[model samples]
Target: MKLLEVKLLTDNLSLAEKFYGKQLGFTRCHLSADELQIEMGSSVLIFRQTKEIKKPVYHFALNIPNNRLNEAIDWISAIASPLKLNSQGEIIADFRNWNAKSIYFIDPIGNIVEFIARFNLPNQSTEPFSVKSILTISEIGLVVNVVKNTVLEFADRFALDIFVPSTSTEQFAALGNDEGLFIVSEKNRHWYPTMINAQPFPLEIKFETDNNVVYNLSI
Candidate 1:
């Protein structure tokens, strides 16, 4: 699956635009006074301005070329500090079983942003990594009240399957493949490598499966 568009909420539009457009080098188009759309490779990341008092932050991951994780890290480090993954001061997260490596960073709005490189994927590039190296929006965390129920609903509604059963549990599940995944996590569960609790806010995702079937999810 591929996430064609992901809509999220934000309270500050100027900062979001400055970070993604000016600093990160992503092209952004202002749809309206309340909406901003950013182009990241094939994916469109949208931020809708909200009047709610509490800011809605989320966790999302971008897929990079299979062999460009290190180069991505170097490129991203110039703009934002790469988050440490462990007390040992390691920045890179090595997911051996998944054949992937990832590094995290916090956006200006406190969103847990990740750039992941899946070694198992055939997408590799000889060019140096940059904003253009981003392949697509691969993952978006959906904080739900019940993981199993959400997983089942997505599977039944979208004809999706669990990505890796062994990597899932009662509290968390990943629906879809490496190209796109809905990370369903129980509410209040701490986000990995951070102590922030997962909280559900309004979000919308438009994605297409490998068979070219498109689906919309709103919550």
Candidate 2:
């Protein structure tokens, strides 16, 4: 599925604005006083303010030039603090299974932001790494009480292809192609890079299929 937009809840709208606008350098189009919309390549990330959402946080990743992972990491570290593993003390990691390199960072609003470079994808940049180098949002955490059923439902409804082959969906499953992935996980489970517990916070996902069919997933 092609991710056209992702709407996430945030506790503070002003803080989210500062993080995406100033820190991440995303071009923002204010939707309203309570909402901020930032352009992430071909994708739109909408941050909606709500007092009802308790401890609003999410894990999402953006695609970057495959050869510019280190350079992009260096540039990002100057603006935001990167998340480091307590065990190895490494900020950048190699996902050999996906043939991708990734670096994690915490946004001002406490969302885990990832910048991953997939070697299998085309990297046409010979220029400097900047915010413009951020391609599309390639992944987003999908928290559900039942992982297997949710994954199957999403795939059936959206006609999304499972990018990662999984034998047991009881724990986790990633649905969709390399362009975008729903990082589905069981509720209350610990997320990667940091051991933050997952919560089924409300979020809206709008995406288009290869045939230009648009679908909305609200949870």
Model 2 residue runs over 4 Å out of place are 29-31, 165-168
Location of the lowest summed lDDT over 10 successive residues in candidate 1: 23-32
List TM-scores for all candidates, in order.
0.96, 0.94
Lowest lDDT block of 10, candidate 2: 160-169
Residue 132 displacement in candidate 2 (angstroms): 0.6
lDDT of 2 by residue, 1-219 (tens): 678899999988998887788777776556578899989888999999999876598999999999888899789989987888676788888788787889998888888889999887896589899989988889999899898788678778887766763334587788877778889889988888888888888899998877789989898
Best by lDDT: 1
Error of 1 at 112 (Å): 0.3
lDDT of each: 0.88, 0.84
Clashing pairs in 1: none
